[model samples]
Target: WTILRTRLGWSRQRPARRAVERDEDAIVAWRENEWPRIKK
Candidate 1:
């Protein structure tokens, strides 16, 4: 859910994201945004 929300928010901010949310981008954002929670 965290990853999904991050992707959604990131997507909204990017013009190209309207085309697609690439797997790599989502994974990167997921690591950057949600990794802290996972580590805890």
Candidate 2:
């Protein structure tokens, strides 16, 4: 892992895991609309 990180610039961090019960449409809507409003 250390060799890969140094030689290949690879990361050791784990990828994010989505919840099994997550709602795709809700997530999309939040990203499209609600997130922009919240960011302001």
Best by TM-score: 2
Q: Evaluate model 2: give its lDDT.
A: 0.89
Question: Worst lDDT window (10 residues) for model 2?
Answer: 10-19
Question: Candidate 2 residues 16-38, lDDT tens each?
Answer: 99789999999898899988988
**Cα-based TM-score, every candidate:** 0.40, 0.48
lDDT of 1: 0.74
RMSD of every prediction: 11.0, 6.3
- Please give, for residues 1-40, the per-residue lDDT of candidate 1 as tens digits: 6687787664334564445646887889999999988999
The residue pairs in collision within model 2 are none
TM-score of 1: 0.40
